[model samples]
Target chain A: MTAVESSVATLDPEEARRLRRERLERIGSWVLPLAIMVLAIWLWDRICVWNEIPQYILPRPGVVLQTLYNDAALLFGSLLVTLRITFLGLLLAVVGGVGLAVLFAQSKWVEMSFFPFAIVLQVTPIVAIFPLINIYVDNQTAKLLLCAWIVAFFPILSNTTLGLNSVDRNLRDLFRLNGATRWQELWHLRLPAAMPYFLGGLKIAGGLSLIGAVVAEFVAGASGQSSGLASRIIEAGYRLNAPRLFAALILISLAGIVIFLVLSLVSHLILRRWHESALKQER
Target chain B: MVPSTTVPGMEGSGKPLLSLRAVGKTFSNGVTALSNVDMTIREGDFLSLLGPSGCGKSTALRIIAGLTAPTTGTLDWSRKPGEESSVGFVFQEPTLLPWASVFDNVWLPLRLKGVSRSDAAPAVSQLLERVHLSGFENAVPRELSGGMKMRVSIARALVTKPRVLLMDEPFAALDEITRFKLNNDLLELWQDERFTVVFVTHSVFESVFLSNRIVVMAARPGRVFQEVEVDAPYPRDEAFRTSPAYAALCRQASDVLVSAINSTHGAAA
Candidate 1:
């Protein structure tokens, strides 16, 4: 038996071939998507050049890139403002959502009484609320943060509630058998069980928070140093600076992509070792 | 091997550790899980509640562990006051905390009892070794196979050194080979620890091999139908698994379980 095992373990030719194929497949997964994106952009640039499109109507990709490079200081500074609002909104949403979720998990009555308000906040358009918020609030940053918070709050609350409630029944029984107090059970079992769901909700909220920040900024339309990327887009539209408009739009989309990737990476890093959703498929 | 007998509560010469008299459980949905179940679990005895699905064996175990209160019965624990906390339960599934390591999982009960990690480490390590999982302290539940996870669950249950251990079909999900191995290891553990165990299983061979006393239960408002004692001596090993006495006891228990299952069908018909 030992002789047969040693022979099999000595790096067989079939094993080498399989390993090479696996490596190629791993690289191809990422490279293929990037290649397709580059081809699409190239096609867009060619269509504009061939049609003799004016800069105001449809700027060439090079024009848009040049506009981005020239306006880097202004656009990038606005991006920082937008990103600050996005991150602040996301952080506040997490705290409020998880705090309320724990309260709801602790008492069904509290959930029944207050969960409707959350739904109302979710369904009511942030644009509609912004007028009321703008009229009432004195601070501009606070108004934008509130709008972003409203948009990003519900998924975290609902998903976390579901997660806290979805604990295994047998595990609960075991906890009860072991004489675990209410706080102990919540701290030890429910919180950890809710982490994956919380992270999932975090991914959705991350994108929404950025949207909220941009949309709120657009609604505000406050000019000067405090204006964000959305305000820049509005300014460019009014001036008919098409390339600048495209540049600002590109920055916003890039910001959204970065937020999504970062949140996904965080979720994967935390859950990779244990969670079924994050674990790699064996075959 | 000791001879077979029909002694219900007189097998071992000691006061009953726990007694359930006329115990019955009815859920809020009006489903009767158990009815008029009477049993006495003595200290240091390996007991198996043998039945078909929905036979209320698990319900009985739950009631014994005080996890679920019986709707219409009383349970008397022979132990003095404050000793009721020394009860351990193993569920059908492993019911492990997937996020915790094997060591942390085993340390849970002690941790809940306010034992610090450093204080509980030795007991946790000792229990893991007894379950043949000494090297798997830091391994998470997701990394272990079904049998190995069950071993960790058993280790967690035994870590507290409970006076009574209630197991509800702990090995029913395992394959035949794993089940046999766990059964043997469990008996060895029981012999070493001398903790009273109330094991629930549907396998007659398993019940006969691991339990000295088996309570046959019937379904459709499940209740105990009969009691069969295998009068088998302790230190039962693989040799006992192949012995004539083991075969006879298994045949007896199987006949009893078959009749119990048939009676449920007959009543339904």
Candidate 2:
């Protein structure tokens, strides 16, 4: 406890307490969520048992999980279909959103003319637009992909535009003084500055893309090899197969979570060295 | 701080690198930032444009750097072909790329001119050493203290070995101790490199300490009010700072600045 002991090798009691508290917090972050999930599942099982609820009305977690294990081939194949749409939608949104945002940054007139159309696409519900998409697109997968892309497109476009436009004024002047071409300025300054915002938009779009795919599948109401989890849920609902419905629902949620975690990891890796948001991690 | 070595001051004997003849700038928003300003910047001269707020001292620096064009009159250049684009600028803030390391920041100008890092390393490192930032090359601007960031900024400016260094209040945001140390270091660098400096600062004492010649400007359609010669020997140090001669020059610049604010003197002076 003496001040003389604070030379280099050891921490004082206060420092030790802080370190212990930090470690506890890190552990609790993951453990608490998992514990709560287990507790919730137990409570759910107990309620079903206590009431003698029929499995058809509200299947127990065990029933749903068992259904998942037994029908792994069907469920996994459907999950891959939904995941394909999510990833492809996300990819198209990134390419189209960033490409348009760059054009917007370059020419104000182009942005002024087209930005309102983008807003229109964002504001209109995908449900309402499906009729038009249904008429125009013959392919079911194309319709689902288009719907997903539309949902995920807005955030990337807006955030990247904001980042590109918000360049430091003095740095812009410095670039001009050096007689930098517009291409060089965009490559060296705007794009790099816009990276954090683009990554932020990417995180939001990742989750949204999955949601869009699920919603599109629900609306399609098609049943087949590539109809995805939502359609499988629909098929289970008409037949009153609650376990299969719950299993499909759980698969969709898991897929969304995995997408979010992967996108967040990418963002962290890209920004950890230089960005203000990432620097706070202190790793 | 380095010891003051004997220096044969340029004493305005160097040829005119560029001249601003009746230059004026009116912003697109209908603000006349500068009016009929005339200046002859000579090679190797330490010149300060001294003024109050809204005096367009910064506009003048921007004009020299060609960041902004003059609305009226001419900026004639006499520099040879290879040196035409050789102007280094430092802003009021460090204005560094937050993502770049100190070394990469210093290598920016050369990079713009198509020099690879391997090609630019010796210049960047030597300048970093001169700025006392050799050990901090890998640190980002956020990791650095204020003075260290400014040192990196200065190193970036000098890395290209510019013929004219245009600094707009580069040390105004810094603390007194850092300012003094930077001032002493800047004097040594100017003496060693002999680059023309058109420094924009409002501080009377700072102007007297660093500049061989000071141009006092008046605001409200900013124009030159008066010019004062420090006429001090080169390699100015802390000893010169405390000397009566330095005090006299400061007092003289302060008087010109006072009249400039009061607008009591005509532009002819």
Q: Report the number of the highest-DockQ candidate.
A: 1
TM-score of 2: 0.93
* lDDT of model 1 at position A170: 90
Q: What's the DockQ for every one of the candidates?
A: 0.77, 0.67
Task: Give per-residue CA lDDT, model 1, range A1-283, as digits (tens).
Answer: 9998887789689887898999999999999999999998999899998988888988888999999999999999999999999999999999999999999999899999999999999999999998899889879899999999999988999999999999999988888888899999999999999999999999999999999999999999754424899999889988889999999999999999999999999999999879999988886
What is the DockQ score of candidate 2, to 2 decimals? 0.67
Report the C-alpha lDDT of model 1 over B25-113, residue by residue, as the tens digit. 99999999999988888877688999999989988988888888999989988878666547888889999999999999999989999
Model 2 C-alpha lDDT per residue in residues A92-205, reported as the tens digit of each score = 999999999999999999999999999999999998897788789989889999999999989999999999998999999888877788998999899999999999999999
Q: What is the TM-score of chain A alone in each candidate?
A: 0.90, 0.93
Q: Which lDDT tens digits does candidate 2 get at residues B54-89?
A: 999999998888888899989988867676657899
Interface RMSD for each predicted structure: 0.7, 1.0
Give the TM-score, chain B only, in order for the candidates: 0.93, 0.93
B85: Cα error in model 2, Å = 4.1
Error of 1 at A51 (Å): 1.9
lDDT (C-alpha) at residue B10 in model 1 = 36
TM-score of each predicted structure versus truth: 0.93, 0.93
